[model samples]
Target chain A: MMGKHAQNRILAYSTPLVLIGILLVFVAAITLTGDKALGRMAAETLIRVVLVVGLWIFVGNSGVVSFGHAGYMAIGAYCSAWLTLKPQMKSLFLPDLPSWLAQAEWPVLPAAVASGLLAAFVALVSGATILRLSGIAASIATFAFLAIVNTVYSNWEGVTGATSSLVGLARYVDQWVALGWAAAAIIAANLYANSASGLALRATREDEAAASASGINMYRHRLLSLVVSGFFTGVSGALLGHSIGVLNPDSFYLGITFISLAMLVVGGIGSLSGAVVGVLSLSMMIEALVRFEQGISIGETQLALPSGAQEILIGIVMILVLILRPSGLMAGKELRMPRFAPRSPDYKTSNN
Target chain B: MTSLAQLFFDAASLGGIYAMAALGIALIFGVMNLVNFAHGEYIAFCVFALIVPSTEAVAVMFLGKAPAFLLIPVLLGLGAGAAVASEYVVFRHMRKATPVAMMISSFALGFVIQNALLAVYGGRPKAISLWPDLNTPVGVLGAQVPLLQLIVVLTTLLVVCALALLLKKTRLGLEMRAAAENFTMARLLGVRANVVITGAFALSGALAAAVALIMATQTGVADVRMGGQIMLVAFIATVIGGLGSLPGAVAAGFLIGGASVLLQAFLPLEVRPFRDAFLYTLVIACLLLRPQGLFAASSAKPRI
Candidate 1:
């Protein structure tokens, strides 16, 4: 029999394995169905998984609610457009770009990676200043950062095309591409959640004074997590832009911010499994509600709920979940295989 | 000199609205640890209440037909009722949850309210001409000022004075203040947490209604998105003014409004469009300089 420590290590590493299994099953299911619309839906859900998992990398570990990750996503999406769009498209639409950027063109993968790097660079610069703030003040400062990014993007007409959707990009991100990035994000988040810096960040999240006394630099760990988080968030944004083949500053604003946060909180803001499960469960619910709104057929009789009931129902569901299980659906616990001989399963329910 | 005077009037008018909103947010945050993100929806809901719920392009006024005296109170009541009901329905049950959880729930409530309005009103921005006479410009100190601008300034002043009185003299206000200062200590001293929290929500809601009335009258539009911008600025103001500090919140609100106006007036045409960016950059600078806020209450100091 394996020793207790080895058994614990196996259990700890089971999360990513379980997550990979879920992704593979989802991919297989989509392939088996061979429905174009279902493929598109799966692509969107996978992209959301990327974004939410990226969010979990920071918020889950640090226990800080960031209203700013969307800003980084915007930066990444625009950067990707700048790199991957045809030189003619850039010169024609984004006329204010410098000569080099106006004439630049790159492959899709390189552009996406560059976009993530650009977002991480921005995150590093901003996090140095922003991470100084703690608690609600830090959250508000991040929000201010979002507002700044949005205002600049919306009004910089020459550079960004100013509030209008930038189009004509190749729609290169399909289900498989999005799934690849989503899996990468899941693995990265899982690895970081078990890393030394991640542990230190969590310690600060639990008790700042104690963490500091123990020589943990709260600011440094926080900034590190934020940079990592920003990188994946940026990639997700690139995938979204490519999926839609258009980029709009409005799409990366308040609507996505709240929804992404909702998914993270609903799943379990403290664990990798929570982030994945939250996105999966809520995305399915939203899809189901959307289908019902589109008049689902039952025994040849068409039935449809109200057009906007999906949004209302989701809100109600989220609220009910919070009231009933404030820690979230997963309650900050990771996924693991069933024991060979179950002796009344026990798992930690809350991070604290 | 005339342009300067005009700028001042514009700043003060905008600032007044922001101050009211900041006060509303600060009140809730003071009493409860939660920063009520749904306060914006309260303003939206109040404006929508003025018209009959329908999907038509042109909105028929349900409350707009009422006399001003009657209309104001009714709108205020609607805002208060919605706010209090939300607190009871959602927040009351979330007392034991973490602040982050509560904050997300508030966001969910806002989402529900916004989508409900969207369903009933459709996604169109409707124009409602309420009190057209208020739109007329009046000469003030060599500058042409709209009557609505003057009214907004005066109303803000009156509301502030009334709020000060309530906080200082009323028993309910005293309990709220005590609760805001320290909830556990206040409860130990016989303060009823529920009553104080309900009172704060009611006041906050009424203030939202007030801002809604002024906004509807000034802009002559009742779009679902109208309140979002102001709410965001107010939230920023609430933080920059220092948490749990009402006067600080009001002052910060006015300062932001003033800075925004100044930037608009002075920036060259090319840069004028990025006024918000510059304003937010200034906000980041302010936060870096004083993370505790410009007017930090003693309690706001970091505890070892």
Candidate 2:
């Protein structure tokens, strides 16, 4: 053990060094990747963060993993995509939504919120049904839910442009803009985690019978957390549509759902830092692996790989994460700085 | 009136498939709550078993029309082989790990198997022959049901009965159930953990392989993607019927089979597009209300 003063000094020096190093690295990565790709990648990563964290809210708490948020995200994306993009194609496709509603095209602000709300609405209804079920039941329900959504979106082309990818909501998303939104989502989840409501959610996850005995209305609490999670997931999805400026049902499949879960597992469930680390590390590592494969030649003839290498890598990573550090890189821990001089009088935690 | 003969015939056939798939999934999940994410891949592997020996070339001498009757033992061997391999590689290390660990590992293993297939088969669907002359439809209310489907249904009944008897009568089966019922008590009572656990994987894997053969016959067209679809449906069936219940799985299989057929038949033009979504909503409603399942276990296992 060090002396109190030495400990304080070490903490102060280490804190700045780590922070500066992280900042420099993040900036360097952004700079090296080119602003355009980074912006898009960051937004995509953030959207993933939202979806994964939303997953953690349910799976992390319940000790049950879900394969169905893809179902929820699809609903959210389609709902928002339909709400925002259909008016122009309305007469041509749907000819169903009331004329006035069909004619209305809201700004990005309300549209994004509407996306979250719409997703949450569905989640609330579905969660009431799913959350009431036990672990595997609830998970399988989501999987069924995804297939159901895919079936609808692919078949119900009238409002959705059918299986032909939805397009033309490009104005709502920008890389940097999405990052900001992602940050806000992270903070919101953090706040919720520390709140009384969050405490109940955590307790339920940790020990259900005790929490239930303590008078926690599990159904209500689960619905609440899911709804909140659904909200962010929806926004991320709308941003997904906006970012791509093109969307289709297949975009959110088992690939995305399980991949996100793997990220959570690798990063550490129940930790915000884990989410960031998972997305950043795996995504970059995956990209790097692909890039690395560029030079290696396979035999008499230069053997270029066909598709699915990325998927294989993901599987390998997931296996690695499970075997080594199974709880994930972070294992439900936060990234924080030392409280050197204690809280200043003026500092306050803001709700927004 | 709806053609009861046709509907029943179709439901029976589809239910046959679902029952097999659900049995495989239920066996694995019951023992471990694993939800073996790699389930579908194994199905693909079974389908590929016949294809590999016949289609992909190493030794041409053993290759021929690959008699249909040979599929049973072949698939059994393939399924058992896949199960043993997966157990050795992934599940063995994960024996005492958390459910999440198994789930992710299963997911990883799934992709690995899938990609390995892709690497070998090149991502296109493969056509495999289980037998000849699938067109004959024997009697049964005058509905022209595929004789293969009939064969499939009878085989299903036989298997389910055999499984039920095995579970209730055999020492290994009893020990397995005892272990599932109460891991600690069974262990304390001298049930060999390794044998019982490996047996569980063996049972499921063999079941999956058998299901894959039937599925390959049913679908006609085979691909790497086939396993995933079967896995998903099997998962849904087991979940709805209640995880870990063999009888429950069969019941759920029949229900889902009937639902899938009906959804295709009675759907209105306006909402025909969202039939799948509607099916999911149906499952969601069942789960939301039942939580445990349509046939959930009567007793808990102390969170083990």
Candidate 3:
């Protein structure tokens, strides 16, 4: 039999292994059988995985519900567009861009990385002020941050094309690229979750007073996690812009914010596995509903629901799931191999 | 001088609507820690109740055609009933969940309600002419104020007075106040949890209806998204007013409204459209200055 230390090591490795396996299987199935539409759908789902995992990093570890992660995504998406769009097009559409940004043209990878760093930097600056507050106040402050970003992006005509769609972006992100990012997000989330800073943050999340008494600086830990969360969220946004081949400020608003939070909460907000699982399952359900909305032909009878019924049904389904499983499907537990299984420290009954 | 009078009237009327919306949000947050993201959809549902249920481009008034006497109560009742129904169907079952989970559930419910409205009413903003005469301007304190503005202001005062009376004089109100302070302690003192919670939902729902009527009358267009921006502002107001404090919410609502109007009036034409950006930055500054809010309730602080 393995020692406890050996088991703990196996448990750590196995959780991420299981997560990567799930994503790889998804990519393989879609690549082998799916057409272009399905390929696009797969790419969207993987990008959501990246986004949700990024969200899970801050929300899960700090226990702060941030409504502003999409703001970072907005920043990332626009920053990548600024860097990668043709110099000529930039001059035509974004005349007010700083001289350096207007003149620069970088490759996709560098642009995406830079996009993440830019977002991370913003998160750090914002968190310094916002993290001093706790609970609902912090949540509201993050929302204000999102609103500021959204309003500025939607109104700054010369640089962002204002409310109009920013078009002609190179569609550089595909299923393969999205899969890589999703995998990276999961690994990064798991690594951070197990790291010392992540542990300190989680401790603060559990009990702020006790954590602080033990010499943990709640503000600093929360800020670090927010930066990490913002970085990955920004990358996901870059990937999203590249995949859609266009950017619109409206796309980063309330709709995406709610949908991403729904996915994260549905899978479980407590574990890395939960974040990945939530996105995978919900994406599949949504796709299935979309296909159903389009109708499935059975023996010459095209059985179809009304066009918008899918959204209503999905909403009801989410409400039901929350009612039944208040802690979400995963309930904060990571997937582990049977022989090396250990009870999750976080898996206590909520004080409902 | 006339411009100043006009600005004050504009600010007050807009502030009245926002104050009502903020009260609805604060009432629910007081009893339950959950912030109902679906409150805006309640307003939308009420607006749509006025029109004939169809995907037609031009809306022929249904309930809206009724004279003011019949139309007002019916719409308010519908709003209250829908809110109560949502609480019973969705929120009641999820009381044991985390606040974050409950919030997402509320968002999902809002999504369902919005899409349902879309299915019945189509995705177009329909023009419904109800009480168009109310749009006529009347000279008030040297400002040409719309009659509807006076009505909105008066309606808000009436609601606030009525709510204060109900809370101060009635047993139900007493229970609600007790629950809002400390739900567990209230229950231990024999206060019925369900009754207080349900009552809060009903009142909140009614407030949402009041906002719907004012908004529909003011704009004359029933867009599915009409309530979203106001709801967001009210939500911010609820937070800035100190979470569970009713008076604080109303005050903050008016403050935000005044600020918004002032920004729009004073800012250069080029920056006028970016008014919300300036407003939200002030919100951030307010939070940093007083994280518990401008008027922090005793219970608003994080418990050590």
**Tens digit of lDDT per residue, candidate 2, span A1-352?**
5555665444433422342344346645775778675656655665676677667666666565667677678777766666676566767666666777688677776878888888889888877776776566666776776787678767765666667766666455655566556666666676666557777877888887888999987777777878888788777778777778877888888788878888888888766667767877887777666654564564655644456676687787778777777778887766666655664455565422
Most DockQ-accurate candidate: 3
lDDT of 1 by residue, A1-352 (tens): 6654667666786788899789879978987899998889899999999999999999999988999999999999999999989988888899999999888899999999999999999999989999998888889889989999999999888888879999987898888998899989988998888889988999999999999999999999999999999999999998899999988999999999999999999998988999989998999999899999999888989999998999999999999999999999999888977544433334434423
Q: Which stretches of candidate 1 lie over 4 Å from their true place?
A: A1-3, A337-352, B302-304
Worst 10 residues of 1 chain B by lDDT: B294-303
**Which digits, one per residue and each the tens of the lDDT, describe model 3 over residues A145-263?**
99999999999999999999999999988899999998888888888888899999999999999999999999988999999999999999999999999999989999999999999
For residues B1-304, could you state the per-residue lDDT of candidate 1 as single tens digits? 4487899999999999999999999999899888999999999999999898898889889998899999999999989999999999999999899999999999999999999999989989998888989989999998899999999999999999999999999999999989988888999999999999999999999999999999999998989988788889999999999988999989999999999989988899888878898998888889888888878777767678
DockQ of 1: 0.82
Q: Candidate 3: list runs displaced more than 4 Å.
A: A340-352
Q: Candidate 2 at residue B113, lDDT? A: 89
lDDT of 2 by residue, B1-304 (tens): 4577877878888888888888888887777667787878888887776565333433122211466577577668778888878888878777666787788889889989898788766665655555546646677786767888788879889999999899999998998788767667789999998888789888888888888777766776667788887788788888888878778898988788888788877998787767667777788777777767778775543453
TM-score of chain A of each: 0.95, 0.82, 0.95
What docking grade does candidate 1 earn?
high
Clashes of each: 0, 5, 0
Model 2 TM-score (2 dp): 0.88
Clashing pairs in 2: A129-B288, A133-B291, A148-B276, A148-B277, A157-A162
What is the CAPRI rating of model 2's predicted complex?
A: medium
Query: For every model shown, what is its TM-score relative to the native structure?
Result: 0.97, 0.88, 0.97
